[model samples]
Target: MLTNDRIVLKILKNNKRRPLSAYDILDKFLRIKRIQPATVYRSLKNLLEQNLVHRINQSNKYIVSSENSHENDVTTIVVCEKCNDYEEINVNKFKMSLAYNILDLKNFDLNDFSVEISSQCKNCKT
Candidate 1:
């Protein structure tokens, strides 16, 4: 991994709850050394390609990929809409087979599957 990629991974590992935007990473990493947005983005792309990180499409932020997440397992991201906090869960293969079964019933070819559920956290609910 590149120095910038390691820096970004460290940031993501430290930040386990809320996701961080590319600019957020750039800002944090900049305190250590000067870097640009494109650099941060490139690091992110590398991390993503390596499956070391996951992107929250809803918020355009990134988080460390769960160690439990595998290539075939489904990654379900539950985000608290109010607080913007998030959690990643790796659904077991049994659940994945069920999904495949459903899709097969429809004659849909399964490739990659991801799910994002939006809800309010306990604190936000009150």
Candidate 2:
């Protein structure tokens, strides 16, 4: 891996449980490296393109991608609004049916989609 990739990976690994924005990652790296926002964003973009990271659309944050995730699989990320915790769940079977139904109705080709649901987590609710 490249230097930027290593740095980004280290940051993600260090905060594996929660998602982080590019600014958050940049802030953390500032202590050890004199990095800029563009550098952090570039690294994050590369990681996202490579599927090493997953973006939570609702929260506008990124999390380490699960090793078990597949390129063709439809992954749904459920995030806790209160605690900011998230979990990725594969909804391939549901996605296939939903995609086909929508495509049949609209006559449009479906390429990619991401679903994010926000709710208070069990721990956060207690």
Candidate 3:
């Protein structure tokens, strides 16, 4: 990993409780270092390719990949719509097999998949 990549990873790790946009990462560094948006983006791309980070597509933000995740683990992300809080759950192998069976029935190959479930979190509930 390059210096910038490490820096980006540190930021994500530090803020694991919430997702952050590229601008968020860039803003954090702007106060201390002279960094460009492109550099932050490049670091994010590389981290994603390496499976060191995961993107919340709905909100266009990124979070650090869980430390306990495995190669075949299916990630189910629960997003709190009201507060934007999110959590990643590792679905068990049985669920994974079910997904594979569905794909097999359709003669489709599965490389990677993400399941996003949006709902109000406990704090947001009435």
Candidate 4:
């Protein structure tokens, strides 16, 4: 049997660009490989520890890391309150946080970067 990380890497490789959730992984395993959710979550936690994936806080979902580490730019997430559907803002097209001028007011150290935006998506706006 392939190791957990390899299994996860294989899944990510197959998806290429699409984000896969822990539940989705569990579902896939149940359908195709018969693995348990706890196992999958453990593998995911391992991946997170290894910096191979990142947790998207807006939707509380996980996505394969685009960069290994030291990821620059803000991870914009858009959440809808009504339908509960959320999405990652098209971060490639815009300078989400690059334009901000960070000035040290009282020497407050800032680390990590992400922007949470809650609004009605196109489908929910109707």
Ranking by TM-score: 3, 2, 1, 4
Question: Compared with the true structure, what per-residue lDDT tens digits does model 2 show for residues 14-126?
Answer: 99997888889999989878977899889988898887888988778889888888768777789999999988887574566576575575655557666688898999999
Residue 122 error for model 4, in Å?
13
Model 1 spans with C-alpha error above 4 angstroms: 100-102, 105-108
Provide the lowest-lDDT 10-residue window in model 4. Answer: 92-101
User: By summed lDDT, which 10 consecutive residues of candidate 2 come out lowest?
Assistant: 91-100
lDDT of all predictions, in order shown?
A: 0.84, 0.82, 0.85, 0.63
Question: What TM-score, to 2 decimals, does candidate 2 have?
Answer: 0.85
The model with the greatest lDDT is 3
Could you tell me every candidate's TM-score relative to the true structure? 0.84, 0.85, 0.86, 0.55
For 18-96, candidate 4 gives per-residue lDDT tens digits of: 5567786777666657676788889888987765766666556666655523444455556666665556543532254
Task: Write one digit per residue (lDDT tens) for candidate 1, span 54-111.
Answer: 8989999999998877676778889999899887889875687686575555665556
- Candidate with better lDDT, 1 vs 3: 3
